[model samples]
Target: MSDAPAPTAETGTVAPPPRPHAVVAVLAFSGVVVSLMQTLVIPIVPELPRLLDAPASDAAWAVTATLLAAAVATPVMGRLGDMYGKRRMLLVSVVLLVAGSVTAALSDTLGPMLVGRVLQGLASGVIPLGISIMRDELPAERLGSATALMGASLGVGGALGLPAAALIADHLDWHALFWISAALGVVAGALVVALVPESRVRTGGRFDLVGGAGMTVGLVCLLLGISKGADWGWSSGTTLGLFAVAAAVLLVWGQWELRIPEPLVDLRSTARRQVLVTNLASIAVGFAMFAMSLVLPQMLQMPAGTGYGLGQSMLTAGLVMAPSGLVMMAVAPLSATVSRTKGPRTTLMIGALIVAAGYGLNIALMSEVWHFVLVSCVIGAGIGFTYGSMPALIMGAVPPSETAAANSFNTLMRSIGTSTASAVAGVVLAQMTTPFGSVVLPSENGFRTVLVLGAGAALLAFAVAAFIPRQRDAGSDRDPEGTVRAASGEGVAEPAAPVTRQG
Candidate 1:
């Protein structure tokens, strides 16, 4: 086969085909659905204890189950998309979303609901595919803008889904929330079929069944251990065994991958200082984001008798989070401009700093509903900027053929971060609840502790982003074979030098 065409940036020497705005919209909408699935159930999580006859602690697993599945599936799907056509895999993911939602809507038992969440998690690959699609379909002039919108879709879908979920769950039954998601999934599926074009760049390789299965088992064990630990007892044999199994499986899998051709994940490139550091930062942001999502709703929905709560209904709490989505949407184009003006590294730094500031503000000003809303905008801006720069960094660091897989790996890191955060946050809340309490809810002290943890995570993310070495957009530094060279003090690869001689 002839060489695959290079992605046409406005400044790229070669230009790819021009994609219509409708196609871009379709790609972005798919991303929106993936993001919506991540947070749409938050309004109902606190109420799950009452609605499903489960403990509040047990109900939290519903969210973590979804996170685990998504984290494991994302990189696999990206690798599959790289081998097969992205359009084919993306369509399959949408089908999973529809089926998952319908199943969840019809189920009365938590068992089937957990099953549905795992299936829905399959859709997490859509965002990475959308980013990959931009490189294939959009001209150079549009790629940056299109990628920026795809990044923002994450925060936008999350922000918008809350109010809609709140409205439906409040007026109708909680099952209605899943039913609505099912309907939206059907619509999104149809739109994808109608508007999205098939990818021209497809690689030939067998699916790495062994690698995929190993990673899946390891991920499931790790996530299950973390998600259920508080309920299962941290020191219990079951949890301890799961942790040991996960560690062993993942370690063996990593070694296996290094020896295999067409590995499920290109761990060598992914482990590069640049890619590894960026992924670490992505995880921290994901952790902080989920921490905020969990804390805010509980605070907003608790009865007015609680000195720390505003006593708002679920619908009101959802509404408070809704504006953050709109603000995130508004910030995307701005992020694009920032990337062009100051480069992705600088843009990411600004975003990380904004997140730290937002968390700091939350520490000082979370008493009133409006205060929470105001702080959310700041957080949304941070998300928009940070999300946009991740792809730009990944795209510029790896070869063109590795784009989707690299992006998906980044997404997977974020999911892992979120899962870890959910687990840790649960532990913090579980430990910090006041003994003198009545029904015994997480007191103001629990929330303060969570916020402090979130702020510290954001600061760690900032440190990671701060240290990522600056590189140009051409990506020539990494070369087609994925080599790195050390320079004077910084680990700068010599872009202009011959690839063979540099390393």
Candidate 2:
């Protein structure tokens, strides 16, 4: 064996210098910065109509645009990363974020704001790409915890950004929020270029433009229909038409993907037991995690006149949620350790059960601020475990060449679940309202119903995770040959071949 680290078969480039710790820190920081975009606009959402001089319906596009852009960009970016280079594509993503932030900071109209938000959304692939880079560059011993932290950054940034953004929106010019985001994006991009190495992993094939376009159209229609259903009236012709278009486009897209030589998503590999079940479980876990996000803030900020409302300010509600982000970061190591000892499947199942328990606690004990804090932290811990294990499960099943794409798809599944949760929760709260003077507030029972549904989603995730086939020990050598045999449902018979590393 050579003294240098081995080169991955897909990317012929040798691993960079042994700076695993620095790389992990930089990448995790970058992920957190990218995820911050998801929540940065929430503080300003209610004011968008007045601020932009647009109707409430059009102002809503500020949020919806980001969602649509992110949904389209994530998998496309992943495929590009796999084809060209992960770090290179990561840099492109961060640059887009910086540009978007600056544009939004300068904007006073809906059109420019939408443009900026869409650019910001393109960076959403950073987490999945960062995880792939970790797998490529880090030693086996360090890979697990590093990727776990990377994954956890998604939640941590969202949780932390809420309060940070609320504070800025309250105290300073609204434009200051985007300026701060721009500054953070600049710092993150600089660090990535300075510390992170470009992975040699490349599939080096023709870009799948047809598949990409089809998937983009299908996803936009589907997510748009689901997200705007409440606003457009679920039974309205517009909503129904969008759903029909989405289904038809996706069905055709699936058929095209099956026949393509180099498809955007590798359906065959994804069909394997491990990958399929993990993706399904991921959807449920995502739904469960987002339900608390939707319900807790409203409960926290509702007026005390209502019997069960906590009657806190937006800032306070954000502060209460902040600790959950810290808990998620704190649990990363523990989640990795569980995966190392018990397997990712066990880690996922444990996480699902913990989430269910957390929702159960929220349903029973949500009358106090401390109750919300406790419940949020518990759910955050569970999410950390589930998020950490998902990439491990995905990477273990797919070829090294397909790592970024596979991880991106898994992330997309989680997004779908969250979107679904938001829609369902919105409908429930809208229909189940209590009268307070002339105004209607979400009834206490409405919140409880949503919590119950959250618990159900977690339990469903646990059931789905239970079906994942047991994987080999993480410490074992993971050669390309072993991956092929495993995908074919055969026992591992050979050790991985060692390719020489230059650095």
Candidate 3:
């Protein structure tokens, strides 16, 4: 076809079209940078009290604040992206990230650091936004792999971040970490402005401030209760009370959404078999994925005196696991191929099985450093396959207009799964420890249990994916080429005129 931008069916306006490869590269780069926030401070997590000059418990908020902020921001940004513009919100998220990085770089206290971290967390929506942009712009044939690679960036950034952060922490001032983050965010933002174009799809409506408030309150309460339950005591009144409040708020919010003319999350769309099941599978996959993270690092770094421990340094541990990230990147194209041929549902089920098998292998081969590398790479491949298929399944089910919101909600499910995994694994390890002189160490059996649980979670994902109806059963009007015939020209109305071309 032509190199020039063509008039979109939704909005008959001609704008400059970015080259497809340039668009994918810029968006994927932006996604990796944004996901890097998840692990940006891992090297300093244990030393937060010393670096921030605060009480140990208080300094923990630096991490918790980011978690809480991201949980609230993901869906909100997705909805806003659908309403205003994905590119607009993407720019806003990047700006917040840069601002946050700068704030943390200059801070030497806990309060300021927590504020900075929260701002950084708010940028987590960029991945979902990137997926939405690709769907709107790319050809159907390229859509599967492009979005899969975008989705896999979450794991890729996280896996790569550990070694990078460890090396920087060892060689440079801690402040340099945030400075690097700031610089990276600036570069990603600049690239996006240069190459990404604003998609013409959008819905016009008042921002659902009430629904937004409700979701924020509900998610914060629910996630806080889950993440901090081990710390605060699972049965503590505080935990129970937060769960109670979350239940009440979410129920009210759901009812309100159904009654409203325009909703924050289209409950109706989300309830579709494909979307709902894929989201559930995402949670299980997330839980399974996180167990490897929790177990591997500690197993690698534990004192050699412990017969089961490999006894490596933090940098060594990171380097060993780094291959997993590369493996994830490599699997992105494979994942797309599987989805294209066998369908995303089949791809998800197969991925979950592979993850389960990887965990099983991990249990059998825990003594050697190479074993760790091998197991991580295997599980990483499984995770890549599953992650790659998720956006395809989601996009196939929901309208193009709600693409960002649906993907954001799916991402949120994964976050919840990881948080739950952290809490559950923490409790297991704490209760089942070996006494090594004055210090207590996590028992070898305890690690085994975590791995087994990871396998179980993966199996659960397989079961969930099995429930996702095939596209024909789903009864959506889609072509064999994977274009949604039902969705064409059935999205949000376009704005009267271009406000500004920058987005």
Candidate 4:
């Protein structure tokens, strides 16, 4: 019950006790578990209408609901983490996942299923929260690779879970998928409770209820329109109205954030050159990454008679994509080393170039399964590098107090990019289709065009990364709390002012 010892001027910040590895492992596991939810229902999406006795369009909400909920919850949860506690909020997120999984498992209708998916989506903050926790608790030496692996978990779980989910959906009752997720969520939550310690870095303040509400409304409107715009008809009044509302709400929200004493997101900090450029680059990288996901699967499964198609089954396609996840895991340490030596900016540029190369390669080699594997692995490795460096860049630029919120904002940028990619790819494929008997399918040229666009996005990210200002050694320029230290003529270090907190 007694308070722990505080750091002294001589000892500096005391490192946490010797369980860093365990902490990293548990956190990375939690990230993977959370990401698994993204693809858990993909195997069953096509059958949802029949199974739930709903229209296909209505059944599609099962996916759209999760996307909208995650977009709204990620930054909100992150801000809450900064105010209250990251670990506490993380546990709450996992609990939502568990509850959602159980609900979905028990449901026989679309209503309950949609509810459960939304709850699961609320858990998407786990990755950014985990990254923020690493920034606070891990040794400076251990932080880079730990965060890289944590970021890579997003791709790792999605790629790996597809095959697993397909296997489950094919062999067992579809309900078993949610049941498995529930078990995994329970394990992840318990591990976090036992292994992760709450940090001393709380940004104590009254919750910004107004800012939070504005952000939620704006993001919900914006993302809802983006995710469903194709279905609603891009030029339809419903879609256009939502877009206009989002723009107005976000403009007001931005003005409000700038004026507020305690805002949900610290706009001035985010406006810093380093943070701004990195976030911009993240969006492009995210767009590039998702385009591959959109194109490769279709190319792999289109009947072999299509000339370019590999004619693989859903399960086979998932298996082929699985190696990319493994490759990403393998690259994390190497990515960390590159960031350590050459700086994260260089690492990011290298990653962007690699991704562009991957897409370029895919354009030339779409005829064989091995070619898809090669391209995916290349892109995954690049993603591993880019994802790894993003947290380092964001953390280096922001105060420790705002770590979770800033990181969550970066994650949101990536999601926005992916959502945009989905929309763009959907439109391209829908517009350019080949007729086969009574049905139509996306043409090979349409898939090629998507891959070409993916390459262009990666190049764009590389161009943006080139503008980020260079920095000193990764951890040397910033203090334990991420406040940049200034050098004085007398050789004493001066700390940047702490971020303001209002009750």
Kindly list the per-residue Cα lDDT of model 4 for residues 1-503, writing each as its tens digit: 11233232334545453588888999999999999988899889999999999999999999999998898889989998888888999999999999999999999999999999999999999999999888777766777889889999999998899899999999999999999999999999999989898865677777889998999899989988888999899999999999999999999999999998889988888898999999999989989999988898888889887787888988988898899898888899998889888888888999999999999999888888899999999999999899988988888777667788999999999999999999989999999899866889999899999999999999999999999988655644364334542211011123455455411
lDDT of 3 by residue, 1-503 (tens): 23444344455544434488898889988998988888888889999998888988888888889999999899999989988989999999999999999999999998789889999999999999999888777655567788888988999899998999999999999999899999999999999899888876677677899999999999999999988888899899999999999999999999998889788888877887888899999999999999999999999999888999988999999998888888888998888888887888888998899999999999999999999999999999999999998988898766667788989999999999999999999999999999998999999999999999999999999999999876531112352225442222235223232221112
lDDT of each: 0.77, 0.88, 0.86, 0.86
Give one clash count per candidate, in the order shown: 3, 2, 0, 0
Quote the lDDT for 255 in model 1: 93
Candidate 4: residue 167 lDDT (0-100) = 95
Residue range with the least summed lDDT across 10 consecutive positions in model 3: 494-503
Error at 81, model 2, angstroms: 0.1
Candidate 1 residue-wise lDDT, 1-503, digit = tens: 12233423232343333335888888888888878987778778878777767777767667877888787878988888877777888888888888889888887777788888888988889999888767556544456667878988988898888888878777898888888888888888898788777665555577889999999999899888977887799999999999999999999999988888778888887887778899999999888777777788778887777778889987788888888788877887788777766777777888888877887898899789999898888888888888888887787666545667889999888877877887898898888875434477787888888888888888888888887877654222232234331111112243443311010
Candidate 3 has what TM-score?
Answer: 0.93
* Candidate 3: count of backbone clashes, pairs at least 3 residues apart or interchain: 0
- Runs of candidate 2 with Cα error greater than 4 angstroms are 1-16, 479-481, 484-503
Itemize residue pairs with steric clashes in candidate 4: none
Higher-scoring candidate on TM-score, 1 or 4: 4
Candidate 1: TM-score?
0.89
What's model 2's lDDT at 291? 98
Kindly indicate the candidate among 1 and 3 with the higher TM-score.
3
Candidate 2 overall lDDT versus native: 0.88
